[model samples]
Target: MRKYIIILISVIIIAFGGFYMKHQYDKKEAELQYFNQAKEKMENYLHENYKNIKEINFSDSYSINPMGGISVEGYLNGNKAKEFYGIYDKSNDEIGVSSVDAEEKSE
Candidate 1:
């Protein structure tokens, strides 16, 4: 009976662990998808509005704050540019461009 109880508890713990892991993965995946969508929108907006800029580039730098705010860094026409894209809402396809900054290009 003692051995059986230990085995049962082990199985239950493993099952709970698996469930928690899966839940975490799903949450992260959703956040990733939202970030991608926001990035795409920002790219499109830059291309259309910032016509003089030859290239709008994204770097490896990215961050997600505790409140789920996202920030991404990149380059604009060879100058460093960073943008803060606020929380994403699927129902509202419009992405709010919170802030954007670009270093002046030097001759």
Candidate 2:
């Protein structure tokens, strides 16, 4: 009876280990696909703005998990978009011309 219990326990552990490894494999595959997609998107954006963009990044070391940092999206916090700081300066004045010219006057 003792030997049977030990065998059953070992079998359960092996089963759990296999399941855990499979889960990790699936997670890695998902991460790779996500990064590939993000890379394609970044390339598309850069190509669209090739004339305007100076530099660009496709991905970072941030994890795709919900309990992690920013990657494609900013954050999952239930906060609405808020303006950090903004100040506008506008100048309006009458147009003026310089008092100097290349044309010569008969003195």
Native-to-model Cα distance after best TM-score fit, residue 92 in candidate 1, in Å: 2.6
Put down candidate 1 lDDT per residue, 6-101, tens digits, no spaces. 999999999999999999999889877767876777676565544465666766555666655565556666665343333333455644444455
- Report the C-alpha lDDT of model 2 over 2-106, residue by residue, as the tens digit: 999999999999999999999999988877765555444444433343343333333244344343212332111222231011111112111111111112233
**Residues forming the 10-long window of minimal summed lDDT in candidate 2:** 82-91
Candidate with maximal lDDT: 1
Assess each prediction's global lDDT (C-alpha) against the native: 0.63, 0.41
Q: Alpha carbon lDDT of residue 19, candidate 2?
A: 100
The TM-score obtained by model 2 is 0.52
Candidate 2 yields a Cα-based lDDT of 0.41
Which lDDT value does model 2 have at 51?
A: 40
